[model samples]
Target: MAGRGDHTTVPGQFPAQGLRAVLGGWSGAGTKPRNDDAISGRIPETAYEMQVKGAIACIADGISTGLNSDKAAQISVVQFARDYYSAPESWPVRDCAGRLLNSLNSWLHAQNRSGSPDAEGMVTTFTAAIARSTTLHIVHIGDTRCQRLRAGRLVPLTEDHSARFMGGSESLTRALGAEADIRVDYAQETMAEGDLYILTTDGVHDTLGEAGMRDRLAGLPQESREDLEAASRALCQAALEAGSSDNVSCMLLKILALPSETLPEAHRRLTAQVIPPAMKPGNRIDGWEVLEVMHSSTRSNVYLVRRAGEDGRFVLKAPSQNFAENLQYLEGFTLEQWVGRRITNSQVMKIRPHEDSRFLYYIADFVEGETLRDWMKAHPKPSIAEIIPVLASLISAVRVFHRLGMVHRDLKPENVIIAEDGTAKIIDFGSVQVSGFRDLERGDKEELPEGSLNYIAPEVLTGQGAQPLSDLFSVAAITWEMLAGRVPFDLEERTALPSRPADWAAGDFAALRPDLPPATGEVLSRALAFSPKDRPEVMSEFLGEMRKLQGRAGTRPVFVPLLQRGSRGFWRGWALAATAVAAALAVALVALLP
Candidate 1:
């Protein structure tokens, strides 16, 4: 039978009647608590929608080995619940889990691409439960355990994704935010009146085995709130005593019935707003005072700003008025908002605080340095040894995005700014596209074109396709320019820009920059190849190959701009035509006299 706490509702309180749940989870690093991750939020009330019969309960544990495992687990649970609650009620419980996972995948891909410093490749194990009447539906991944405690017996509801369970794959074979495809285990069962459901991370289960768990949980008196709390504490203490050095957390949910005074209050809570408000230029929102407009594009407006009640300043970005007015533009804006708000990566910009606003706004630590374009213009391209770290960091950021199943369609010298400390930041997400996730539930072929014309992947230019490798090609092009100090493609006035797949496929960078190292040039060649399949399929491998050329380094070569004096033949002839024109006019007049 299903436990009573297996109901689904939005996060926070409910409007009517249902179950009560408490959550606890813990993480261990063997000798020290590296990451203790767990979360439990009850919809304080209950409701009866067509597809949903009871409330929803969720528990998540991030695989602690990845960076910021604790944070990953916490955000996954909180954000998933938050999104499920706000979602339209058309989907069944399983469908809801699928959609939520899709959204999480997209966000994780973006976060990975951004190369979140704290948790770039972080993965988590979690289980989410939604109850309809007496039925409980669960979606789970990783080793985090989920079980029902009823009639003084413990019943396991989810399986572990550990190495032992997967034929000695020492690492987690499945986890949230770890890959593009998450393997979720789902099941359903009926609930009992006095049932209790518990979810916990490995730290709690590793120390308190099945028998140990039953002993503590069964002894608790259900009638007394204090006894329940004490029993939960005793279980945690027992894990610590058993030499579990991880952060331990657990959740306990009790299933009961409708209370007369609770229903009305629960109903009112459902309509409350959770998103923050939009901030405009020159307006102070969340203590970041907007100062001067930095730049504006079709998508967002960047501003030079100062922090409130602080000495430091930062850069703020908000979606343009045009973008905010259109629902399509909201995708880019909301993505930035979601990525900026949830990630705690130093490499990523921080989300600006807001109140009940929906548009995107974020504050980036202002880099006091020039862009790669400006730097290359002022000084010769630095040696590969000097360039590796910068390139590596940038590559890592892109990897972060790729892991989340996203492609940043644009990457150029102008988009990468190098701070005084030599840290490279790749910005501008206007052209990013999700591979398997779409807000409108539309087909991939139907999505509109989104990316810069110059740096666009060949397939994207032809409206043929886009993938993670496409973005890698663009990154290679930018890296080439960073070292070569000139774009690989330079078309004369007589020729049109290489806007076609044929142009990109046949064009040779070696012919343009003969001075570039042959090995480096070949790497760039394959990356910018006309077909997406010809490029590096994965970012990590591409980066690994690029690293080989970094320290081998070459001397800076003199660069002739595409528009040099010798190349401006047509303009020079036009500039010297005045005397010739007069002489021609005189001869014509003399001929007319004859």
Candidate 2:
């Protein structure tokens, strides 16, 4: 049997229109007694879902030796695609697919072990391609393969996990339900216009070969859905005629168009509501009454407000009317709402729904706390013990963003709120860098570094782009300030800011906090390194070191042997000794001559 279809995002649905593509698939029993091959694909209907999850296409081929191989293949393809979409949107594509595949494999493995007599067990090869924004994410296992057709050339994207014996017979070394623990191959590629992703089982590709497949695809009209479907069927048919007996399946996803701004459509959606003018307390707009102005700035205004009949207090953040015409700023302001709505964590501020509002603003849960800057002021010289808990909470919160493929580009003391109970909540999404959103953007626009000079990563200043390591740099700076009562680098004192990564240097932590252990300074120094490569790769590693530092207490100053000290200290001591010896030898020589 052969099957095919297509999916396209509804027009004019999102402020920034999302990924667009065409999907088609075909499967056949070939010369086999029964088809154990299955193919499935999904493209979300809503713009939000389309942007977050994008689309997924899967193909699975069951082992002929298994009693329920057909059922296993069907479950693998259908359930894998269904479960992928059901995963949390906040998760990165790799995380979503990896976690789902692991769980699915475990369940299938358990089912196989519990089967009755006469059941040989269930096993199948699986491969899937996920297209989100402008990236293609691939996950593969066993002999099923994923390939890309770009610029009229076929490119293999996955390697077969099979082993061949002396007589040329082959068997899968890895497959779903074949083992208790599964190792999946995952990779990603930048998607381009007119790219066609192909997924096929061994029955099709092993027979047709890459050359044959490429020639067939080259002959088809790439853009037309009908032609794409016809090509899928044709590939399976050709494979069957060329010889051998096994189930044949193929799936094709063509990139119809990459995301580009439909300006009129985007402008209409983004500017649906007028930017509200500045207002003081007692002002009313959009059902919510302003109680007090929480913050005001040239970029945005944050107001503390409450609904007419509700006792709950909320914070309403509105972009400055001055930027009403600044589409980029407006888009970022809108993205704040999008990000806040998707992230559901107590450590991160939550954006509440206000469907009836008529103004261009978003309401979030009002956190009762002082800014971390103020917290630092109250404890100018806090011990490592006092700072560890706060750092722990902050690290946990930042990891949440990292896991979601987001970098809080503007992490600073003012951006973190320390509640009365000591919990921390990260705020201000104005400068967040989201991986998915980056793909939606139309062009590269040069912009200044987002965070404060003292806290922003050195690499970001040099246009290396915001990353998880950048956030780590900011956190380390904050921690240094908490202990030393000053930023690691007095950025304000410099005549000119560092324009390159090599020019940036962190102040000596040992000089500032000599009373603490040497390891303490070493830890902070590494985290505050000018090169991100010099820092810990993950937050957990950095946090683990901090935790170790917390257990050590302030020790009385002790004299150290020159050899035991740093290279600089050891070399300086040797130079002083040599100077004394030369002076003594010169005096002795003068006395002997006289």
Candidate 3:
């Protein structure tokens, strides 16, 4: 522990997401002749940088094989700290850190290959901890350690990358620059205020055994910043006293504060934004001229709009005036734009938020093309060659939503635009099911399912939550319509499907599309399975089967025969029953007339 007179101030501060962190560390060579270990960290002073880049701390240990081993250690830790912050703010912590480490590893490997005199091969063990937005991201390699000290209880957070060989010599199994390509280990954990993290080189941990270290880490009160530093210094010194042979290094990080508002509370604030007035072609709002009213309905209005002095065209979408006060509608509208902006793809619409415009409106690219619905109208029998690639792009877009724990429950030709370049872009996120947002949106109950019945999965009629397979089913329906010009079974607009599974199976799509290759139509038919479990488990499987159908005319797919359609005459029985009911209704009407 530090003496009362030794009140060492921290080097810097990094604040973000309504939270504050106090970082401290101490290092030494211990009994070793010279130190070959390094510790470094960077905390951004600006909120934008802090929220995007967050705070990063790392430790590196050099192998004794090279004479200038310390240089490798120093460069690894210091460069990681610097380069991590300089990365683009739009990237997530995991992506930014992973990419930088990969680049750094390649550079270090190149240095080793150069074979220069007096130059130690640039290879070292690396471990980094990133604190960002109520979460902690861990990027690790080699045998260094990272742990969380929460509620005075030590929580081990990393697995050491070391193995014992046949000769009983322990060696690092993974380390940056150890080979031409490195596999970085990554992990994540949610964070809270009063949380503390401890980073240590193997020298410190190997000497201070588990029980000894656990006892020392327990009961670290938030007495003062010096106390935290004192704990770190004591841990390092204790390892030296225990006869550690290598250089010892340790870093301590404390979460002094965390954001008070829940995610739901922050989301509601977005809904409180001002609603825009009704728009017209000649009217200008927020400095953007409305060129044309593209589409409008009970839900929202979309307009072709542009800002003066801007070279590119844009589309503006706003909630319907009547639904301005509807909280669910507002949340859906906000979420549509939110999801649009987060996703990165040319096939997915890009939503640009207007910082100055308080009105509830968002601008996106004015893509030049027709909706897949309209395009299908023009090309009813689109060649398999044309539709396959376009549909593949659309499936890829849906996969992005799946990766983010969301489901596009309502997928149809109307919601997809076939761009002039033939790329497919999905739009209208009103029916996107965000699995992560359920807790935040629990208060806003949906009275009914929010999708067009023509494309909705049969299981949805049984009041089941929308699953990714449900979206795949909708995708199959749209593909079917493009080729066959109709759904498997005729449906009234937005009408409820038969509740029974038996009735659903009776709609044999094979009977109507006999011209299509049995294998091709067979694969698409799997997507229309009444039970999600019976469908392709993933979109990739669906796409793979579709790809296999290309250029193979003789391959007969596993055909599930139209069950009980011949002798039993299911449709004929249904028609007869319907006619009988109609006659009874007529007789009752005549009696009433008399």
Q: How would you encode candidate 3's per-residue C-alpha lDDT over 1-594 as one tens digit per residue?
A: 111111222445444556577676777777677677788876677875665456677888888676666777777887888887665444456666788889888887777777875554667898888887677889999998998877657787899999999989789898877788989999999898888888888888888866677777676544344675678778888888888887788777778776565546755675667777778998888898999999988878889998888788899998888886566667677678878887777777888767666788899987788998898888877656657887898898788777766788778888898888778888777767766444334434562346577788876656677778988988888888887788765555535568776666525545655555666667877888889999999999998887776665544355667764566677789889999999999999999994
For residues 95-188, write the lDDT of model 2, one tens digit per residue: 7788888988997898788866433467888999998888899999999999999888999999999898887989899999889999999999
After TM-score superposition, what is the CA distance of residue 236 in candidate 2 from its true location, in Å?
3.2
Among the numbered candidates, top TM-score falls to: 2
* Candidate 1 lDDT by residue in tens digits, 172-272: 67887777776678888867767777777676887888889988777566443344445555676678789877666565555554222233443333223
Q: Which ten residues in a row have the lowest lDDT in candidate 3?
A: 1-10
Q: State TM-scores per candidate.
A: 0.48, 0.81, 0.72
**Poorest lDDT segment (10 consecutive residues) of candidate 1:** 1-10
lDDT of candidates 1 onward, in order: 0.62, 0.81, 0.75
Q: Count the backbone clashes (under 3 Å) in each candidate.
A: 45, 0, 0
Stretches of candidate 2 off by over 4 Å are 1-18, 110-120, 147-159, 180-183, 187-196, 208-231, 241-244, 262-272, 325-328, 356-358, 446-449, 492-495, 499-503, 510-519, 537-544, 547-594
- lDDT for model 1, please: 0.62
Instruction: Order the numbered candidates by TM-score, best leading.
Output: 2, 3, 1
